[model samples]
Target: MFKKILIANRGEIACRVAATARRMAIQTVAVYSDADTHANHVRACDEAIHLGGSAPKDSYLRWEKILEAAKATGAQAIHPGYGFLSENEEFARACADAGLVFIGPPPSAIQAMGLKAESKQLMEKAGVPLVPGYHGSEQGPQLLQREADRIGYPVLIKASAGGGGKGMRAVDKAEDFAAALASCQREAINSFGDDAVLIEKYVQRPRHIEIQVFGDTHGNYVYLFERDCSVQRRHQKVLEEAPAPGMSETMRQQMGEAAVAAARAVKYVGAGTVEFIVEQREGGDMNFFFMEMNTRLQVEHPVTEAITGLDLVEWQLRVAAGEPLPAKQSELQIHGHAIEARICAENPDNGFLPATGTLAVYRKPLAHTSFQRSHLRIDDGVREGGQISPFYDSMIAKLIVHGATRAEALARLDAALAQMHIVGMATNVQFLRGVLRTESFSQAKLDTALIERERAVLFNQEPLGLPLAVAAAVAHTVLQEAEGAGRDPFDRRDGWRALGAAVRPFAFDFHGETHAAQLRYLHDGALYLQVGEVAGPLVIGRLPDGETEVEFNGRRHTLRVDELGGTAYIFGTQGATRITAIDRLAHAGDTQAEGGRLTAPMPGKVVSFAVKAGDKVSRGQALAVMEAMKMEHTIAAPADGTVEELLYVPGDQVAEGAELLRLAA
Candidate 1:
């Protein structure tokens, strides 16, 4: 095993690698950008080195700087933790040239699998099952459109050199093909510096299952089963699990063989994943076609680890140090089911827009990062007060759960997500809980389009139920009384007391709507609250689990309090939201823009314009494309309008909500 290794990445993955390296008695070095100088990964490593500026280009993506830091720290090997330079073939070759081992697939394998087009070609040559599409070298729009036509409508336009959902678009009709292709190509050029794209047949009801394959320098290889990554949004995975739901033993063996074939075709070394898109037909054929192969450890690798009882990072180190495969494929066994949900700092209600803020309070459930037998697990890198910056991926943590069966695992996932307490930034926790409660998902009927197809019912931001309003009122009363009762006689209690008059009604906003609530402090052991005709007094009970329980009418609700910038947030049966003590200056002015004109949603470079100064566009029509967080977002017209101004051109880097185009209603 290597004595010291450099983790050429940051954030949770870096920390994850460092933990495994430490367990194996290998010292770890961490590289960080200026923005991540105080990052969790840097604090976890044995040694740390500053890369460069805050932007990824200046730091994480600078291969030379990373190499220099690795050498200076005396790290014998470099582990590219999933992103940035993980799949960069040149960087892998550079590490090899510098006499440092790269704890990943060989540079030749990365080169062959890096480009989607070439990988597809290689898979086809190796007789691996491939989807019906065109991976040809043609770049002309007309030619690509012809290939799409040949493949069929509902074709996928994907960047040949793309990952993380960047430079990918699904066109359901021929008319929309041209615009989608142009937008995709522009994003491809900007993100990957390659405008090359390919056409693929879009599989309806597709389940994304990828096989985890490991290879050693002695040409021995074994597959670690597969992970079902069907739960996705905007072509990005939100949840994943090992031993795919509804998977048969026969299907698992077949996929294992096919994945091994694809890996062997490239003479793959170290860890890699062979992704396949399995189509669910009426007969349950389990026919899977090869997607591209990821030439590094996956973000969802923990699920595999939970099921297999193997440390993939330790294996990476041993293999890079000229060891053979740790165990034969036959010896490996799937102990139980494991599921992982990505907790991202994004607003699921607002089209899943990414949000950023200092984590005033961040607390994971008291579950272990790895479970024995069946339990909940969490893998994360952020802590209390960590900043969820916009310069990197919005993912804050990966919550994993294991159980004896799929049903149990799903239930644990729901519980863990509900137990998650995060403040200072919006999250998709409720959205994930909704997914778990979904009838189709609960029944193991999932597909790539599950999130998009069920988005409406799954993402409810309304505060409609009367019970929730009453609970909020009671919780509010408890907090108010807690603030008042604990003080001495000199403290003023009449913010709304008004010297023994009618109770003053106050409004509190939760889940985007205001609730009218009345509060009265009682001399009893509880605080009294009234909402319309409903009345209740909630008792605050301390729980053994370190979380407070709010009780009312023989029912108990767990509450987690988080304070951010003087604002108090209460999470529990009231769902999750900011709970201020009914602000004194409550009649705040509207934050909506004066003219109701549409603007950019985030800081990104404009890549496409569908309208000019005078073109008429309808509501929800694609008006422009903005690329941010390595993904493209199509900003649409808010309402039917005539374009009055073109505020930006292609390649203009604009701030969030900066005017991209003015549309006159």
Candidate 2:
């Protein structure tokens, strides 16, 4: 191994790479932008370097700055962890020119698979299965429309240069093809600096399964099975798992072989993933088509690690050091089923809009070392009190669980998600939990459109459990007393109120609703309370584990509490939130009808505005589009009404909750 290596990335993946490097006794250097000066990856490294501004262009994407940092730190190699400069062929070549080893695939391999248009041609040349579409060099709109028509309706217009759902559009009809092409190209140019796009046949009920491939300079190669990445939103994967559910041995072998062939065609080196779009066939075997090859370590690599006993990062180091493949194809085996649920700071009920805030309460379940016993593995970059800035990806953590089978893995994932406590930001945790329990997912009947199809049922936030409410009531009372009295008033003899006939009435707010609770001291460190319309008294006790136990009307209820910065979190079936008890009269002006108006969900530059004042529009009509965190969101009319005002224009930067437009009801 080298004396020192630079991690050309940030967040969890950088920390993940450093961990394996540490075990290998290899010194690691971390590079950070202004936004991540105190990031977790920086703390994990043996040495760290600042890379200037917070914006990606000013730092992470600047090849010269990263190269200079690597040279200055005396790093002999660079590990591009999946994004930013990971798949940039020019960057890989620049590292080679700088006499530093690139810890991923060779520059040639990256060049071969970097562009979608070129990769499809290479796959077709290599005899790999491909979907029928246009990968031509023509850029004219009429020519592209012709190709889309030839490919059939529901074609996917995807940018040839980037991933992560940017510059990707799915057109369902010929009439929408022109506008979709323009939008895709515009996003493509802005995101990847490449307007070139490719048209592909959109597979109905598509299942994204990718094979993990490892290669060495000695021409030796092997496969680490496959991961099912069908759970997605906006064409980006939200959850992934190894040993794809309902996968047969024959199909696995075939896909694995094709993936290896695609890699070998480019003389690939190091770790890469060959993603295939599998179409479920009725009464027959599924037809798998080559999508593209990711020329670096994947974001969902932990799932692959969970099923196999090998450390992918360690293997990357070994291979980059000119070692042969660790194991042959026949020697590798899948031990158990593993599933990874990406816990992003997004609101599933609100069109999955990304949210950023301080992590007031972040707690992960216990993680296990091996796959032999069913266990949970949490890979995260942020801790409690950390901030999720608007400058980077909204993903906070990834919760992975392993079990003997897919069913067991799903069950563990569901349980782990239920136990997770996160506040001070909107999260898709509850949404993920609902997805795990959905009948379709439970049955392994997954598809790319599952989220869009079952969103209504999955995101329904109706109050379902009474125990949760009781627990919230109890926590609210305890926190209020703690704040007012400067300590737990139910501490010693002072807690006893036997000499008086007085009770304390406290008000609490949660989920836009209010409740009243009256508390009085009881023996044995218990507090008695009555909340809302409940007829009987409630007893609240704190357990040794710091969990709050509630007994309402003789019925015992258990709940987990996470307190941070005066925000109390009561975790149960009612879901998670930052709960604060306040006097209704004091903060009466805080409420607003912001969600009812067409506003920018996040701070971003307005890309386009389609409607003006007095424009009659129906619900869900696109009124404007805003780009934030590198993702474009179409702001639409909430209800059928006339546009009363247009408050924004193209090229305007608006803050979250800033009204961009208004519709008269």
Candidate 3:
């Protein structure tokens, strides 16, 4: 085995690779950008090297800088942990030329499967099943449009060189083909530096199932079953599971053999994934078409690990060090069912726009213990006080659970999602929980449009009722009192009322609305609170473990309170309620009108502008597109007006809430 390996990536994958390397007694080196100077991945490695700027193009994608860092650190191999330069054939060749092993597929294999257009051609020669569409080399718009017409009205225009839903568009009609193609091409060129694209017939009721295939230098190959990634949004996976829900033993073997054949076709070595777009029919028959092959490890590989009891990274290291495959195909067997939910720092209610901020109150649920046997796990590279920067992917963590059966695994996942607590920024935790509880997901009736079909309930934001709001206020007050209890007895005052002058007035803000309440200490030591039309007398009982128990109206409720700065985050069975204590006196004259100003919803760089200064646009018209967290968000006009000023041009990096433009009102 190699003595040291350099991880040419960051975030959870980097930490994950380091963990396996360390377990195998291989020292790990981590490379970080400016934004990740103090990142968790950096701390997890044996040695750390500084890359360049925070942006990927300035740092992680800089092959020279990464190679230099690896050489300087005396790393025997460089592991591209999925993203940055993982599938770059040039990088793999450069590593080989520099006398350093690239812990992935050979350069020829990567080149063979790197481009969608070329890979389809190769798959066709290999006799792999493929969807009927256009994979020709013609890059003309008109030629592509003609091909789309030949295929059907509904066709998919995808970037030939990138993954992760970047530069992908699904057109439902011929009229929308041009705009979709242009947008897709723009994103393609911007993301992958290639404007070439491929058109394919859109599969109806498609389910994304991928096979995990591994090959060694000794001409040995094996398949680690499969993962069902059907639950997706915007062409990206949300949740994944091993041993696809409706997969039969025969179908599994068929797909597994085909995937292995595709691997052998490319003379593939190391870890690779062959993704398929499985079309489900009403007659219960399934037809799978080859989508594309990912030349590196997949983001959802943990699900495969959970079910197969294998460390894929360890296999990669062994293969890269001139070792044969760990096990043959016959030896590998699916142990149990496993599921993984990707927790992202994105707002589900806001078009799933990526969010960036400090993790003020981040707490994960307990892992599975020997006594508990819960089989719950959390894979993350973020800490409680860490910052979710805008320069990288928005995925905060992945929650994986395993059980003897699929039903049990789903149940454990639902409970685990509920136990997670994250504040300071919007996340998809609640949204994921909603999906898990949905009837369709619970019954395994999954499709690519599952989230869209259940949009109403998935994006519904339950109102923070008065009871929860009041509980937050009371919890905050109780915590303050407890802190003061250790001080002088004379300073420990608990809402003392002298002459009934409205004891203490407290203001709180929830979801941008302010509310006021009055609290007083009753003669019997019970606290009385009047919120709006409701008046109740409550007793706050302190528990030994710092939990607060509220007794009101013959009902007792236990609450978990985490106070960060001035915001009080209260957790209960319903969910988490974050309320900020408002200072009425300090904000008496802070009423500002928000009109005629177009502000950024999040931090990102301006990708394009639909309207320039002095241009007349209607309400809800697309004004600009911002790229953040590797996703694009369209900013629209709030009201019909003339564009008076365009504050920032394309390519400018704007902070969250930064004003992009203003209209003449």
1-665 per-residue lDDT for model 3 (tens digits)? 89999999999999889988888899999999999999999999999999889999998999999899999999999999988899999999999999999999999999999999899999989888999999988999999999999999789999999799999999999999999998898888888899999999999989999999999988888889999999998799999998899899999999999999999999999999999999999978999999999999999988888888788888899999999998988888887799999999999888899999999878888984211123887888999889999999999999999999999998889888877889878898878888888888999997898998988777756634666567656756766776777566667667545555336778888778888878877655567777777777767776787677876545677777877767887766556567888888889998997688989999999999998899999989999999988888889988899999999989999999999999986
* Model 2 accuracy (lDDT, Cα): 0.83
Q: Residue-wise lDDT of candidate 1 within 1-665, one digit each (tens)?
A: 79999999998899899888877889999999988999999999999999899879999999999899988989999999998999999999999999899999999999999999999999988889999999989789998988898899899999999987888999999999998888788888877899899889999889999999998889888999999999999889998998898889999998899988988999999989999999999977778999899999999988898899888888888899999988998899998899999999888888888877788778777787542344877778899888987688889999989888888898788777767888888888878888877777888888988887787778765422544445644554545555556456446443334344334466665555566777565433335566666667656655565455666654666766555554556677435655544464745655554774777787767887888888988888888887766777888877888999887789888887787777778
TM-score of 2: 0.91
Error of 2 at 81 (Å): 0.5
- lDDT agreement with native, every candidate: 0.82, 0.83, 0.88
Ranking by lDDT: 3, 2, 1
- Pairwise TM-score winner, candidates 2 and 3: 3
Candidate 1 Cα misplacement greater than 4 A, ranges: 370-374, 461-470, 473-481, 484-488, 492-502, 521-528, 536-556, 563-568, 573-593, 612-617, 642-663
Displacement of the residue 96 alpha carbon in candidate 3, Å: 0.6
- Poorest 10 consecutive residues by lDDT, candidate 1: 494-503
Superposition-based RMSD of candidate 2 using all C-alpha atoms, in angstroms:
3.2
The per-candidate count of clashes, in order, stands at 0, 0, 0
TM-score list, all predictions: 0.93, 0.91, 0.95
Between candidates 1 and 3, which one is better according to TM-score?
3
Per-residue error (Å), model 1, residue 351: 1.0
